[model samples]
Target: MQPANLLLLTIVCVLVAYGVGYARSRSLAMPLGGIRHLKSLPFYYGARAALWCGLPALFVLGLWVAFQGKVIQTLVIGSLPQEMIPGNEGEASLLLSKISNVASGALPPSFVEAPIVDASERLQALREQSRFYMSALVVSVAVLAGFLGWVRIRPKVNARVQVESILKWVFFACAALAILTTLGIIFSVAFETVRFFDKIPITEFIFGSQWSPQTAMRADQVASQGAFGMIPLFTGTLLISAIAMFVAVPVGLLSAIYLSEYANKKVRGVVKPLLEMLAGIPTVVYGFFAALTVAPFISDLAASIGIEASSQSALAAGGVMGIMIIPFVSSLSDDVINAVPQTLRDGSLALGATQSETMKKVIFPAALPGIMGGILLAVSRAIGETMIVVMAAGLAANLTANPLETVTTVTVQIVTLLTGDQEFDSAKTLAAFALGAMLFLSTLLLNVVALKIVRKYREQYD
Candidate 1:
């Protein structure tokens, strides 16, 4: 049986075990007059049975699925004649692909040698045998384990204790998986970044002025060993993000304040959803709007004012990005502001403080940490945004603070570097990982700063 089919069968077995355990528990309680006679409830007994029936079988299936392909490939490669064996990883991969195609009837038998045809047949036979054995073993283990659980169920058995114990470990495993995954990403990026630094000096990448990264593939080809400097990209990113935050923070905060404090229920209901609808619109749509409408208008206005502006400028992109991320700030700030104790506002009012004065001093100070968090989230959103920047800001990599000039961000360059068909071994590809590492560190620093602010304000308010 196939893995998917086996999985379905195992689920059916678990459901059956649950039903049997539940019924038996209730039956056992009949002579004693009620289910209260049992050590634990029927639900816990059912759950324990289900866990016993599912866990071991699933563990076996997962291991088999993970290792079967590699085991089969190793066996096939071992069986191949010395002359037919591949010399390197790339050649081995190519050979495997061809063999897979032939085995699946994607390639004709006549297209390859008799030896390949024999190998393909062996591969098909081994796969079929492996599936049959895996299905039988999984099903057998599930049935045996379930029978034992059902047999062990008694009026004195503590099924709830066993079930809860298993569940606590399951939750711990999930948390560990999340931590491990994050560590895996950091290490992978760090390794590639180390490789990138080996190819280009750390000082040059960090401080050099130029931004070009194009490297020649061949010695005879024309290319500038290309600058790996990141100063320009980081500058553009900050410039665009600053413009966005300038546009977003005050507007979003004021809107949140009005909605939470002054607006009636009806107005809040209608306005809040409409405001959140901005977040639902695709970034691509925002990019088109920025490029076609905003960028052109900004250019024309700049020209009218006798100031120079690029057809695609950072101001246009940042403004549109700010508009896009307003929902993040407004929604979060509204919640934070609303979360402030109503008694505090009432106390300020009773003391003869005006509404505006109370809001500015009491309410705002209390919610400042949460509001800061929202702003930090919006700033991160602005920094990471790519579509609007690419469409409106243009990928010029200009080391300028002017919002009216063209610029490119680290994210845009990372996308550009990794977009096309590229080899992972090249410095160009490794540069993307380096960029990712820097971006991660930049966000980490921002989080540290935001945490400091939150703690400082929280201390003051407390």
Candidate 2:
């Protein structure tokens, strides 16, 4: 049976076990006087039975599914003659691909040698055998464990403790999985970044100004020189991000203030959704708008004013990105502003302060932490944006602060470097991971500053 089908059958068996255990628990109670005669509730007994029926079978199924293909591939490869064995993991992977393609009939068996055809046949047979055994084993284990649980359900048994303990461990496992996934990402990137730094000096990457990364792939061929400097990329990132924040912060914060404090319910209902709808529009759509509309307009306006501006400039991308992230700032700020105590506003007004004065002196201070959080989120969005930057800001890593000139961001460069098949050992390709590590550190630093600001003001407000 297919794994998905097996999973559904396991769920059905767990439900059946729950029903049986619940019925048996109620029957035991009826002979004594009521449910109060039992040490634990019938619901607990049913949950315990469901856990027993589901957990072991699910564990076995997961383990088998994770490793079955590799195990089968190993067996098939081992069966091949000595001359046909792969010398390396890459060769083994390529051979497996050929075998799979032939087995699936995408590739004709006549094109490959006899050994590969034999391996493919063996692979097919082993897969069939594995599935048959897996289905039987899972069903048997679920049934046996469930029967044991149902038989052990006595009036004096504390099934609730067992059930609770199992659930607690399940929740802990879920939390650990999330943490481990994040650490896995960090370590994977960090290892490649270390390899990158081995080929390129840390000082040159961090401090050098030129940004060319083209390198000759072979000794016989002439190619452009490669440089690994990240200064220009970071400068472009900061320039565009600063411009976006300048545009987003005032407009979004004011919109939030008006929505939360000044607008009536009817006006808020109509305008708020329209405002937040900006966030719902796909970023690709914004990219098209920025590239086709905003960039052209900005260039024309600059030319008319006797100023030089590229058709693709940082200003165009930053402005459109600010418009895109408006909802993030406005919606979060509005919620926190509304969350401020009404009595505080009233107390300030009772002392003869105007609405604006109360907002500035009382309510705004109280909501400053959350407002900072929203702005921080908007800043992160601006820094991480790739679509608008690629579409509006042209892909030239010019080390210039002028918003009118064309520039490119780290994300755009990372996407460019990693877009196609490339050798990972090349400094050009490994540079992407190094850039990713730098970006991670930059954001981590941003978060730390924001947190410090939040704590300082939060303590005062509290």
Clash totals for all models, in order?
A: 0, 0
Q: TM-score of model 2 relative to the true fold?
A: 0.86
Compared to the true structure, candidate 1 yields what TM-score?
A: 0.85
Tens digits of per-residue lDDT, candidate 1, 1-462, equal 999999999999999999999998999999998999999999999999988999999889999999999999988888889999988765777787888889999999999988888889889989999999999999999999999889888989999999999989888988998999999999999999998999888998889777878875666643368777889999999999998888888889899999999999999999999999999999999999999999999999999999999999999999998898888899989988988888899999999999999999999989999789768867877889999999999988898989999999999999999885466667787889999999999988787887787777763322
List ranges where model 1 is wrong by over 4 Å: 1-13, 64-144, 216-223, 303-307, 459-462
Give lDDT tens digits, candidate 2, residues 1-462. 999999999999999999999999999999999999999999999999999999999999999999998899999999999998988765787788889988999989999999999988998899999999999999999999999989999999999999999999999989999999999999999999999999999998999887877785666543354777899999999999998888888999999999999999999999999999998999999999999999999999999999999999999999999898888889989988988888899899999999999999989989999789778867877889999999999899999999999999999999999875566777988999999999998888778877877777763323
Q: What is the lDDT of residue 82 in candidate 2?
A: 97
Give the TM-scores of the predictions, in the order they appear: 0.85, 0.86
